[model samples]
Target chain A: MTTHDLEYDNPNAIEAHNMSVYYGSFRAVKDVSLAIEKNRITALIGPSGCGKSTVLRSFNRMNDLVPSARVEGQVLFHGENIYAPGVDPVNVRRRIGMVFQKPNPFPKSIYENVIYGPRINGWKLSRREMDELVERSLRGAALWDEVKDKLNQNGLSLSGGQQQRLCIARALAVEPEVILMDEPCSALDPISTLKIEELMFELRQHYTIIIVTHNMQQASRASDYTAFFLMDSDRTGQLVEYGSTSQIFQNPKDERTEQYISGQFG
Target chain B: MAVTELRRQPSLLRAAFERFIQVLLVFAAAISILTTAGIVFSLVFETIAFFSEVSIVEFLTETEWTPLFSIKKYGIWPLVTATVLTSAIAMMVAVPLGLIAAIFLSEFASDNIRRTVKPLLEILAGIPTVVYGYFALTTITPFLKNFIPTLSIFNSLSAGLVMGVMLIPFVASLSEDALSAVPNSLREAAYGLGSTRFEVAVRVITPAAISGIVASIVLAFSRAIGETMIVAIAAGQNPRLTFDPTVPVMTMTSYIVQVSLGDTPYGSLSYYTLYAVGFTLFIFTFILNIFSYWMVRKFREVYD
Candidate 1:
């Protein structure tokens, strides 16, 4: 009954199978399933509080930090159930990184911020190796040139967009297989948002990217395919449409999808 | 309406009333400054008088502190050493336990458990210091005496331990506030990087909250150094020149109290010694406060 029920071929990076997320007793995200293709950008576009962020967080088991949050079904990564017993959420997160809505750089030096993940994972590197990793990660996020001279400066001292990129660089240092961005550019200016969009396209060659955004234009422009989420009768997020960006934006199968894409109602 | 309001000048009475309110507020703010100035002036004046009789060199370098007894050796080291020893012990107890308790309360405990437990922890700080003094004197010293044969009835160990107990809730409560003030986004970033709970709390959150935590510890240490009741009740009256916590030792506060309780003639050298010691205590605590301020100013990483 839901678009989330649709299936994809093999070689998918992440697969949420009949997953439902609940906050306390309320079903915040209804029974919905979706397959995220490998090395492709999948944008979850929806209105405010449509559970896009919630469903995205469930993939890496970040929702486990919430005491009352419970997942009813499975989130599979590379054919292994992430939510299954004895599968550590910490290990799950090691394979899948996340970026937040706002620019949340740790109040540390730029150099320290990038190395924090690698250090905790017990990767002992030489001074030269560390410098290279920092450079590579910063370059990966397209932030190396702006911040090369002062690696010792606080990460929070950067501009809003640069801080977000530093967060992206920090995530990249961990070298996760999939990167989940929860409205990464919502707080950014248009130019910075474009920069992040461009960076996403570049990042798609290496990591599987899943982003939740409210901007219709951003979804169509930045993603290869988009999943449109809307509230159901019970006010829980239900997938209404799923297709390629050009197909959903140009021609829609459902009236609701048409109304949403045409800017009638979000 | 804006032009009319801008064009009009205040009436004489209204202007005078505003001036009066401003002066009143300024006077209210100046009360603290005036009090500090008064205390400083009085302490310095008497400390100079005490120096007239007892040399500054002897006060700093001499090991004896028998101003009340027959020997009358005026070295200030015994009192200073005793105060430092007790405060060090207090810090040793308060730092690890209080910080762990804070981390537990902020990062580990659930909402229900936190709601039920944090208030109970704070209640420990609310208990009067006099009761702690008695608890140290009547109960703790006796319990400790069973283990250590050389433990005196009035020893620094019991007093310092009880002082640490009293300061536990202080350090824990303040540090919990600092640790929790770290934005959840930072924790998320760490978690997203595959950091375990312990790693996130220790490596990420602790470093972020370091300034505030150090501030709490320094403030608690200042409180410990200035504490009187527990030291006076349990840590004996004689100022001795040894680092041994088992033996009875006197602190600067205890000396001041001992002198103030008995009859010391006004305008005498004995009376001036009180101010001298009080001034020394004041200087130590002032340095600690300044250090705390500098640490917070220099190292604080502001997260918005």
Candidate 2:
């Protein structure tokens, strides 16, 4: 299958060209082609184990960490193929950052966690520069006011909601062009989830945000674009429908998407 | 009615059986505690008897340890110094190599490679310490003699090096387990932030697993301190105050081995020295293990 180049009114920030992600012989996501536009929140919504996370992980080539996992098609970032020969996964990831399902702050201080990305990538900032960056990133994630007094405290010391926000701050510190979130709010409480949803809306002004979520309401509530995925007969996940959130919610083209969103079937 | 009663409560017979099982388990747990207590009791009285014959101040302050020699010096320093020198050498050899092996096993190796290689590393641990003693005496001693300027035939250097080889599995296996235990999410987060494999493994993964790795190394060092065969064979039984690894020096274990091998009269002063040395060895290792426990507690990142 080839990538479907639809008449997208918005220019593409990233294009997944018939990407079939596999683990050894088993295909997890089969021939998934998606175009995520710049400055927009695109939600990959589906039932559990539908390979939405796999599709999201492929954006940063995180699936490369799994020895058996392989990607068969091109994932183009700003028109450059990420999986092409000689392309650095580190460089690809620097351009496109990710937030995991659970809040995974590094086992370090809050200040250190925010600056970890820049530090590893050889950004030799002065003490003042580091302090400012830490503040800016924390503020960017909407956690600075709550945690400014305790920047030296361990990242894991934060509440679950705060930890998730800290992870967002850590990802934001690198100044990534695209942010991929895999169920970033799945482990958060309702208030925290709402806060994160608000942060996503604000973040859409700067980053091309792609989020994988099992929550139907999160997709309908937060994302501008919603892509519904369903398991095929063979159990490999495939894209069922893609459209504006309002259209997908009100008038889903596929019956499966309607069934899934209406809680009729999963 | 019987089914409903059974669901509501366990039968008296079954309850009594469960209590019997719990008592059996508790008795099993108490056996090790009793053994430890017994060993301590045996060591304490003999140690007290040895100390009564030789003053504690003289045992500590004096630099020489030649109670069996014509001169009859009785300093613990000679044996203590030898133990320190050899154990330090063992740590030097084991720490870097073992940690690197752990890092390789945990972070770099493919799953197939890990499955085969991890057991091979454990095989190093499985090899008897007596075999290590022979390897130290014959192979390491001769090999060092060829290269080192002042390396001796029966020296602590060979014993320490070979003992370190024996201990590599302990450090590597535990550390690898620790590194692997660090949730995949942590690694993913590091990678997602553009960390290279080296960066992720060292800077991120290592920090997260430092307590476990440090505990492994410390336990390996303690094992090195207590090791008998390699030190006894390769490191000679001659007690010397010199700190040099190339010289023949008697460790506490080796001295005890030398005495136990010879038929010294029962309850003699020489026989009493074995208990005294054993007590010292016990104290040192006990302190070391306790310190390790404290350090592990101090450094634990508490990821969960």
Candidate 3:
């Protein structure tokens, strides 16, 4: 479906209704409900351990990796329930790609990393077609010119920023409709962060993007919408406010959002 | 600044104690190095003495190995060929079974199942090689002779098969560690792309850890070649060059045992032959160990 239709119908690429994440007896995220818009960079901004990453991971069931983790809620993607029984998590992941905070490039050449997804999914293209796809994906991540000549070089040989971008390229090569980035530029330098921010802007044109970040400036600079999540006195995160970037930064509906934005508290 | 602190010059006693500890550590390391060097030197010295009496060309090229015979013909080929044939059979049995066990332990088995199965498998390794030798001689050989009429009571087949079982744990444990060292992220990435678990393990994980797997195989092969007790007890002490498993054969270790147990004079060329055999076995294992280590390091995945 088109982004316009998604906006008119739901204004969200994904919606979590009354979501709660628990690690055994400990509740990490409590009663969090938020809607992320399609074709817009929706930044989940919060301090560390505020359950922002947990909620982001729940989108593609990445939290399932932790044996103790348990989730209760409806995570809707393209108006379909992702957490429903019989809905294959692998298929869900194929449609929704993830870029981790730290650059976790596969121990392989750049060309191999980018084409890994397509190759696994049985994309039987000729060598020329595969090469073209690799170039296109790298260009989409704004990493083409820098690595065009070094496709055969190891992915680990790239600089921190370049590796993160290569990871993004790897994710994009699978042709996912949504991309989930967890602090994509936190480990990078300022110049690399700016490059990533610019790439995020470009990415939103094609893919629905949801990013979790601790950098408020990055939320303001890169995101069209901002979600402010906060932990209460019990250290359980709950959604405080989510709205257009202008409204959240200019005049938040919640006082906590204002306090956080004004640097009164984190 | 107001109070003047009085400090003794660096205590000679403390300095001496620290030096003592350093000396102890250096001595410990030196002992290990020296032990290996001494063994090699002794083996080489005795082997060279034996070769003086028995020409090097005769030892390597002669096909018949009858050192204790009236004619005293000495050929190394029979012993070398027997060792290779037995080792080959042992590896053939060990490699596939060990790899499957490793896959099951690392990939398929549940935590509870692994906890129970791993130690049990290790028990096989812990059984003294002599016990395996006796079992192979009394039980396995008798059982095999019933099925295959041509099987000798003291055949290499039964001994090699039992030796393979003994070596399984080494191969399995090392391979399991190698497989487990593969990052979960790679597996997750593969799964995220719709690859099956089998596909992820076989195609990605195995290739990624190819070096470790190769090293484990080399180590298992070395273990097979150096194995002694089982072959000595079950396989006949006949150093005849033959590829037939149903026939009796002798490995290098078995030949040394046979010569040592016999009434050969200590200073005779026959007695020194033990050192020559020992030196050959030592060099073989040493080269394999070095190659395996190199392979493991060369393919190691260095993560930032």
Candidate 4:
């Protein structure tokens, strides 16, 4: 799969062209080719050890932090290969933000946590503009009403649900065009998970979202499209199926996808 | 029941051996405790004898400390001021240099480089302090004299600077451990938000591990206060309450060392001052350890 293949009337926010990731000599994810549509939620679903999270991390070049991890193919954003020579991973990550499975808000005040991304990215704003950015970001993440009274409080002081929302607000403050969430709701309660799902629906009007999750119900409920992955005999994760959520859930073409969706085996 | 039969058939010899091992461990632990208690008791006993002759008010308020001379005046301020001055100079050199090395080791160094360099860096701490004292006297003092002609042969400047080099490994190793203990999730979060490695390190990781970093600093400062050989050998035995690093002055530890090695008769006033100075050093280090513990408990960021 090449960038030209996906450059049609509807543009993709990001596309991975036969991307394979290796940790030292061990291949973790093998030849994953997918086009992430703009302004829609795409869920990467698989069992544990299938490297769905690894694939998601590679999209923003977060795997570059791991000294041994290496990417072999191209990740294209806005028709340019992000892995091309001289393409700075810092700038790549600036346009593509990420949220983790754990709500890792910095050990700072809630307002500081929201502004951290912008601050590091060197967005020089006036005090009032900073305040407005914080308010807007919090509102975008559906957390302003709960935390507006105590923006000075430490981010870790919030409940697990509120902390996850604060992380989302922090990610949103960067004004990223794409957000990669690696099981962002896996650590939250069901109510918090529902809030995140609804927030995803609202965010689909603006930014593209690619999420990796083990929850089959969540993939069906929250995402418009779903990509299912499975580990091969060599224990490398490969995409088994990719389609609209309804097609993947109701009438999966691959027998393995059906087996996985029906919980026969993972 | 089978459970009752198994309990009834339990091996008495193995149980006896387990109890014996437990008793041996208890004795081993008790020996160290008893040794510490004995030392503290002797220090307190002699310190009391010394204070009976010299009033605590005079010991503290008097500026001159010349217990060895014929016209003896007992003042602890001179030794205390010299100790503080040397330790302050040592900290000024150690803190920035050690912290930068720690950040490099923890945040920037590759796995191969860090593994190869960290142990080599730790070897600096393993070198004998007596050697460091001589290095300060012979090498650093002469080298520094080329730049600052006012430097004395036995100046606190060289002694404190060499002590700082000796303390670098202590600060760097402990601080690296603290910085490395910060969960990778925080680093990932920072980098995910477009932060460069330097920004992530200085902003997120350092602040997260600040309690441990501060505890390392406190422990390093405590070591500096209790340091004996470096100051005793390179810093001269002149008990002058001066802040000038270029001048020769005696610290509390050095004064105690001087009295211990010299022909100060047993049970004399000068001999008893050894216990007083030792007690002071003990108290200073103990307070710093307690403060480090408190800071660790109070400011630690508990990440789940």
Find the candidate with the highest lDDT and give its number: 4
Q: What is candidate 2's lDDT per residue for B19-115, written digit by digit as tens?
A: 9999999999999999999999999999999999999998898888876667776788899989988898888888999999999999999898999
TM-score of chain A of each: 0.95, 0.95, 0.95, 0.96
Candidate 1 residue spans exceeding 4 A from truth: A1-9, B1-23
Candidate 2 Cα errors over 4 Å, as ranges: A1-10, B2-23
Interface RMSD of candidate 1, in Å, is 0.7
Can you write out model 1's per-residue Cα lDDT over B193-225, one digit (the tens) per residue? 999999999999999999999999999999999
Summarize candidate 4's per-residue lDDT along A184-213 as a digit string, tens digits: 999999999999999999988989999999
Candidate 2 chain B worst ten-residue window by lDDT: B65-74
Clashing pairs in 1: none
| Candidates sorted on lDDT, descending | 4, 1, 2, 3
Task: Looking at model 4, give its docking quality level.
Answer: high
DockQ of each: 0.79, 0.84, 0.47, 0.88
lDDT score at residue B6, model 3, on the 0-100 scale: 48
TM-score of each: 0.94, 0.94, 0.92, 0.95
The C-alpha local distance difference test score for the whole of candidate 3 amounts to 0.87
TM-score (C-alpha) between model 4 and the true structure:
0.95
The interface root-mean-square deviation of each model, in the order shown, is: 0.7, 0.6, 1.9, 0.5
Query: What's the residue-level lDDT of B19 in candidate 2?
Result: 100
Residue B163 shift from truth in candidate 4, angstroms: 0.2
Q: What is the overall TM-score of model 1 with all chains considered together?
A: 0.94
